[model samples]
Target: MSPTLSPSPFGTAKTLVLKVGSAVLTNADGDLDKGMLRTIADWTSERMAAGCNVILVTSGAVAAGRSALGVRDRNLTISQKQALAAVGQSRLMQIYAELFATHGFHVGQMLLTAGDMEDRRRYVNARYTLEELLRRRCIPIINENDTVTVDELKFGDNDGLAARVAVKMQADALVLLSDVDGVFSANPKTTPDARLIEVIEKVTPALIEQLCPTSQTGSLVGSGGMLSKLRAARLATSAGTHVAIANGKRPGILSNLVAGKFVGTYFPPAPTHRSQRTQWILHGRVSGTRQVVVDDGARDALLHRHKSLLPAGILRVVGTFKAGDLVDIVDSAGRLLGRGIVNYSSAEMDLIRGHRSADIAKILGAKPYDEAIHRDNLALFEEVTSAR
Candidate 1:
């Protein structure tokens, strides 16, 4: 379904996920931008007074670490970075606690790693904790657990982390606060004719490629740039969450954006589905295993409409996957058809390969069912792809 572009239904949204980029929250020397944080806190407090639930995903642990260590070196070891994060996290929370308390608002710190989201049970638990905190009228401040997260398990940036948080909580909107005003037709400073994209109705693959080139890099303090922000917007919007990319430096921008003032680049919400199950299958989790090759019939059944994957249509299964594991469905030529949760382990499926539904019990000794991957557990990855 095509998403529609329009101003947000003002003051109606209950929950908002605000992502503050490192560049906006930290200086070139990797010091925290105290004034900017105060502005954000004050604005968030006003929104909370208006009965809005605000969840902040902030990036600055590394920057704060650098500042604490008085290190101006561009190339710091991973251990050094982790040490900095450990030292700076407490100081960062102290600043936030002070700022929010001054406004008579209670704040809670939540540190997350990729592992938290990768496991389904842990993900649900984390969501419950955040929801309870919001229910108690306490703002949840989230940051990557940099002290424990190495390169592999890290989210790589706050933009991606915030998007995951929005998806997890089923948030109403995602506001990405960055240094720039919004998405531009071209590099704003270099291209004089470049204009700001006011509204993005749909985030297409072409748009993703344009905003995020393959070699694009981020600032020393920041990890992702407009590319990551665009991907985050696409992810959130597809899950029926409205997104806005705006300048954090602008005073009162958060309030303006939330009020549907058309402050920056606004991405409209996708069609909302009543069933969270369908939504989760369509967009919630990423596939864990590699591609699963199927025949054209299987591809048509899945893409054209909702249909359960049958073993008869299965061609090949790549990757070592377990029962109930998420795997990508691909065509005979290796194009991604969609993603679905397998009912049988890879080993079992290998033995049952190309077998009829009637012979499943004989092949595997026991059968979950005729279908290898059920339709209910499958999610399609058809949205904009990250150029990164």
Candidate 2:
């Protein structure tokens, strides 16, 4: 039997991340839709009046950039696109500032690159800034620093960016406003009989593979489609944030979504609490400099007994990392097993590999502890598997 769908605890959410997609905020001509902006601003202001802290992640800089530069060509190079973003970001923010001010609300702009979250110190600092803004009752309007990000570091879309923001802020809910009503069984344009999936309790690998196949041409300014939204929903929901994908073109959509109107597809939060540190590791926000591949014995020991990883079980070590740097754990077949902070460096582990705990000091000429990754610091992928 399918699990019953339930509304997230209303008015209990202290912090919310509202993600407005490019298609929702811009017209086919790639111009900002003032009417749509006003509706969103008004609804958000109402929530703020009710004492709910809101952070907005918006897309449209590229669109704004295109309009500002008077570029009608769709095949602009990355450099040209970046140039447009530089010009349009400020213009987009100006519109937001003016619209929000009319509702008597203060807003702050925060531009981030993927690097910001990849570095542990920067991650903490970003969280601190957002918290400070919320404490001061100011809305933080966040967007990816497209002008600075290289292709590899780019979040690819605001939906993924929003998920990262939600994880950073420990937000209770993430509302993704897009052009479509919600996620459907198939691409709505192609499959006229496609049915909307009203609620999702869990996103399985199979379900992830079943995401909409057709890509909706984004507003001249944005770069995401419904598939990106679903991917974002999966990421956010896995991090323990309730996510809703709704139509941004609909009137008062944000308010209606939060008011239990069931306006769009809702991805329910994971039933367990994922420790913040674990979430960061699992999400790959912080890149691990090293990796260790374990055998079946080590995998079983870690997954079933919650045992510390010993040198004897490690088959290979990849990359150089410090003692405290997060590292990936993989199996013999090369699939990622999990991640944990290593107690020894790759150089140190190489000498100690396949050795017993008693031989640690004898082999390395020194020792901190017998285990490579203490049981306490390790989180297994089996936990997620069992949750399913």
Predicted structure with the largest TM-score when compared to the true one: 1
Between which residue pairs do clashes occur in model 2?
A: 63-221
Error of 1 at 104 (Å): 2.0
Sequence-dependent TM-score of model 1: 0.89
Clashes of 1: 1
Q: Rate the local accuracy (lDDT) of all candidates.
A: 0.77, 0.78
* Tens-place lDDT digits, model 2, residues 1-388: 1122334432457788999987898887877888888888888888888898899998878788878878889777777778888998999999989998988888999998766765667878999999999888888999888788656223256787788889888889898888878888877767899888888887765576667545443333467777677777877787789888888887766656666675688887887767776676665443534689898899888777778999999998998887877788888888777888789988898888888889999998888898999877777663444742
Using lDDT, give the best candidate's number.
2
Instruction: Predict model 2's lDDT versus the native.
Output: 0.78
